[model samples]
Target: MMNMAQARPIAPNSPSQKQKLPAPRRGLHLSPHMVDVAVQVAVVAALAGIWEFGARFGALNPFLLPPLSVVLGRIWEDLIAGTVPVDLGLTLYRALLGFAIGAVIGIPAGILMARSNVVRWFLDPLVSIGFPMPKIAFLPIFILWFDIYDTSKIIMVAFSCFFPIVAATYAGCSSLDKWPIWSARSFGAGERELLWEVYLPMAMPQILTGLQVALPVGMITTIVTEMLMGGRGVGGAMIMAGRFADSVGVFAGIVQIIILGFVVVKSVEMIRRRILIWHPESRR
Candidate 1:
């Protein structure tokens, strides 16, 4: 009924903008993550403060509780003089070498077991028999065979790290969504194409998680080997400190190992976040 001059233009999307893109609602944000971080910081600060006071006033025995200051001072001294770096570098080298060896054997073994029922049948018994046994139980035999050298240490670590990787990878691949395989095959996808597109992508999260599970074990294996083998490491340092009854060194070594484990775990988590950015929890 309106004339042409009275016609109006349609506004560009204001109602849809409000309705479709509602404001980010807020409520009880029970972020366990932030709470966990806060609690850790608070506890650590409290303990440090307590240690500092107890040490200064002689309330805690200096021999048994050497305090944060002493431990930090010793660590700082070693850090500055390059001793800690050298020892830590050697430890890192051993850990990496062992992890690499384990991965070399584990990935293919896992893939084979996953794809072939016959291979899984043959290997399941062997994996079950060996997986639960502590790898350190072989330390004496390893020493006798490999003569307390880096080879034995590396193998021990590799052995400890291997089973978890294989198990997780096998689980991942075996349980992969079957639809992808069927869809790819219907399209005449080759074996390699199916593996690349369907198998690997689906299994990657589990594989990375397996690496996470194995990494700390690798670190511990190397340190334990160092302790038993009398070579240089924080573990060896702990042993040496205990023998000399040096509480400072013993606690310092323990703290050092704890820090190393924390760092390694954090690194793994960072890698997981970066690589598996599409994971559900990660998206949240």
Candidate 2:
């Protein structure tokens, strides 16, 4: 028989019998991302201030290194006149079009290479050779083949962006863990279902990273081609400004390029987050 004392229920308000639980601590918290953004803004502001002071006081050549104010004023004037917008639109169109083409080609090629030894063997050497060679060197050949119009420029941008996307995709595809594949197989998923539901989702983060890499390359290539070919782009505007020795115009063109690039990259990041909602890194 059990003792009455051992079997008795503890009184509800007895301090000695009750379990002690830790109270939840509450305090002010700051996000690391906020801190990072603050630091970056501070640094950029400091640099701009120094530059402005130098230019204003003639510590730097006003002709060669205009004040940030002068540059900003020129950018505003260009914006008001609609010149910047037209040039910016053309640049964006070419860059994005090239990027789209490259992405469509490169992603599938990368996946094929990852899945088939035959495809890998056939393409690996070409990728290896082309990846390191300066893509700009091929511009002359492309121009000769496709003429000095938008076609050549688009092709150049696509070529420059392709290697990065393919490399990133291939790396992502090959580096994927086998557990997801095994789990899908255990569930009796066929090859097509596994490709769509398992492998693609697992590879998506890396594929997005590849796209990110390719985007910047496409923009850069478009700018370089425009600068060389001299037509209908921010790069062409910059070239003309340089030719006229208009430092303010040159700087304004640069600012436009910076703005355009930032907007595009941020858009890509947003798309990446949406696509990778289930990914832990993407959430952060």
Best by TM-score: 2
Candidate 1: regions farther than 4 A off:
1-36
Q: Write candidate 1's Cα lDDT for 102-184 as tens digits.
A: 98888788989999899999988888888999889999998888877788989998998899999999999999888889989
Worst 10 residues of 2 by lDDT: 15-24
> What tens digits encode model 2's per-residue C-alpha lDDT throughout 11-41?
8778865556556899978799888979988
lDDT of 1 at 272: 89
Clash count per candidate: 0, 0
Q: After superposition, how far is residue 6 of candidate 2 from its true place, in Å?
A: 29
Model 1: ten consecutive residues of lowest lDDT: 9-18
User: What's the lDDT for all of these models?
Assistant: 0.86, 0.91
Candidate 2 to truth, TM: 0.88
- Model 1, position 9: C-alpha lDDT score: 53
Model 2 regions more than 4 Å off? 1-28
- What's the true lDDT of residue 11 in model 1? 56
Output the lDDT of residue 204, model 1: 91
